[model samples]
Target: MKLTLKKGPLYLQVQEILKKRIISGVYPKHSLIPSELELKEEFDVSLITIRRAVEELSKQGYVEKKSGVGTTVLDNHAISKLSKGQRFSEYLIKEGYHLKKEFASLSTINLHEHAADLVEHFGDECYCVERLYTLEEKPYIHFKHYISKEVTLPENTDLLLDSLYEIFFQQGITFNRFKDEFGTEIPDPSIAEILEIEQQPLLQRIRYSFDINEKLIEYSVAYYNTAIHKYVVNFDV
Candidate 1:
């Protein structure tokens, strides 16, 4: 995979990608990740860069280095959650469902359309991206993400290739907290057409993500196709 040069340090970008792999169970827990030389070949970076990335993961408790056995993954899902429980994607993935997000468009837009909804929580100007998530190759959710004006989005961002949060991280914006509101609504005709839904009530979720300073970083509204799969939330005791 090619690393973006401007996403902080090259090693950090490699570390974040490796972190995602670990979280997704690609490099399963208790398994050894690739050797520094192997990772160097995979990422087309120097051995020092791979070593630093691995060392950073090790320091974060995701892995541990052995004298000769190389680094081994210690945990698979150590990443923080948006709320108190697992997200719908995590729940579905755990249930053996394949989920994919298809990118439709990414551009700047005014929040005038959402003026009657949650527009008060965000600035009038934002970077909007329209995405549709699929489950088992079937339309499942219509997602609209409105990123804060504080982030300067690069033209090369591919929402289908990377998670939107990860893309935001590339711009040096990190979401530390999120507020979610759930409701039922009849989505707009365009969103209805994208999700292949009739003009009927559907499960809706509004999320506002914030940085450590409590400033809004992202605002998103998602409409789920409840006829295909109901939204699930887990509670861990």
Candidate 2:
């Protein structure tokens, strides 16, 4: 397939194209992908660009490269095991599960002392969005997201129904990296009620997302109902 290459970085665009092909089984598991020369000629891009794109695919577990051989697609199970750290919501969708997010509340609020420390420089105010995540139409998790007011959110946008990162990208706000801390805790009464559980230990994740400039732009706490879903984290040795 010819890539239009009209948007985003050349390498990222190429990566997406190749990833789609692999996921759709166009290039079946263990099948060799086109060579660098072939891909360069096909995309009309430089060898460096093609190499970078392939490297990204390898890092994401879509393909594996071997010396004296070639790049080959990995099986779906292998791919799932190798994706380093994926967003739970995105991961669920990729696993062919129906996922939905419902907003319990969305509003701007004065940041409490605890929240103020999370986004160190965001002053004393921020936007707080509470949401419930459903997997296959059943409650699976709950999330409370606190975003820096400095990062402008689009008015009238349904923060619950849309991908927050996508919305931020549209407004020229993007995260370069994020940090996550995981722990187990008994859910509060309100949280337990939302997750449709009773006196159960929940997996909790505290995530801090930073912009390209390394500024903390978002802080979120998520509680997972492990009875309904499992959280997996992959590490490369």
Candidate 3:
């Protein structure tokens, strides 16, 4: 309950300590947090410090405070921690590749020809978020994501820096396996600039579908710079 800020700034240290405890199941989801007065005594910190730490957690959707109810822990298994199953980026990072991203667009749009079928599955309600991945600032891949309107996205968030999977996870969505298809192609001018490859550098086109709660909720298409990224998927038996 009490922590000494010995390694980092006081607020960040407080944030991490509380976050670890919450993640460790010390506070289960929907469980009310200790009152502000209780936490002040627990951490021996000023009210201002405790307030700042709690605010940080709130921004990440880890905790909520109601008018009469004390702060409560939000279910966040999907956002804060990666599931036992790995993501493609996680797999790449484990292979020692540096990863970064630049956002291009995140908005709602009418379904287009190529995306029409996908849109129908989601009941014609969709949000498109686009971003370009990079390695140390050089454009390496372009990602376009489509999500159902059932998932509420925070307004004006930067997709390049934020993880879409994490966003959906916090909304109580999870993916087991869907469908994926990949091939090589020449990039259109727009995708070319977004990904920052040569005029034509053997673009790797990948389209993936996600299964959420036995419903197909998302579809995405990505273009990767062949020279910089080696997209690989392994199957066990």
Candidate 4:
């Protein structure tokens, strides 16, 4: 895919971008990657540069190139480890699933006590973003994110399709430590409507995230419809 990010050497950037796509299940395991000519055209680079990037991916154990069969992606079971955290979405990618997420709604509102005194870190108001994730057009997970006032969001919600962590990273707010509380709860009527499920017991997850300096930066909750799929996290040692 073509991205506007220009970082480091062109070959290295293309390699990293392709590597991320492989790990994120875009070019899934055992699938044939685009031709060298295709990638060269996509990145607007030389064929030599494209080959160099693919060579790096092969050396890194992310792909295997055959004589005439082209290049195929390798298993990405260690994606979570590479990403520095064990997340459900990463695990799904590893298990060969394409997950799509979009903003359902976004608003700035006064922080409430339910967020455990988030006002101390974000004063009175915070950005509330409602995100819905679908697998093959079937809605399954609903995420309600409360971001700190310190971080600025995009004026166009369409530009916020990436994960919150990626967005936070762009704003110089990287959260390294996260605490997750897992349980089952009857979702609110509004949340149930978003998930396309009636009010029922759904798997819930609460995340308290901290930045490099151990400062709490975000608080979010996610609801999962287990009837469709289960959440799996794999640990690498």
Top candidate, metric TM-score: 1
User: Candidate 4's residue-wise lDDT over 1-237, tens digit each?
Assistant: 554445557787787678667766889889999999999989998898899989877765678899999999875542222233356776887778888885567789877745547888778889888888898678989988888878888877776666566666555553435788999999899899988888999999998888746787778899999898987766565
Off by over 4 Å in 4: 1-86, 113-116
Model 2: per-residue Cα lDDT over 1-89, one tens digit each: 45555776888778767765775578888999999999999888888999999997786666889988999987432233223556456
Clashing pairs in 2: none
User: Candidate 1 lDDT (Cα, whole model)?
Assistant: 0.77
How well does candidate 4 score on lDDT at residue 60?
Answer: 57
Models 1 onward score TM values of 0.63, 0.61, 0.57, 0.62
Ranking by TM-score: 1, 4, 2, 3
- Quote the lDDT for 83 in model 4: 36
Clashes of each: 0, 0, 0, 0
**TM-score-superior candidate, 1 or 3:** 1
Stretches of candidate 1 above 4 Å error? 1-79, 112-123
lDDT of 2 at 184: 95
In order, what is each prediction's RMSD in angstroms? 8.2, 6.8, 13.2, 9.1
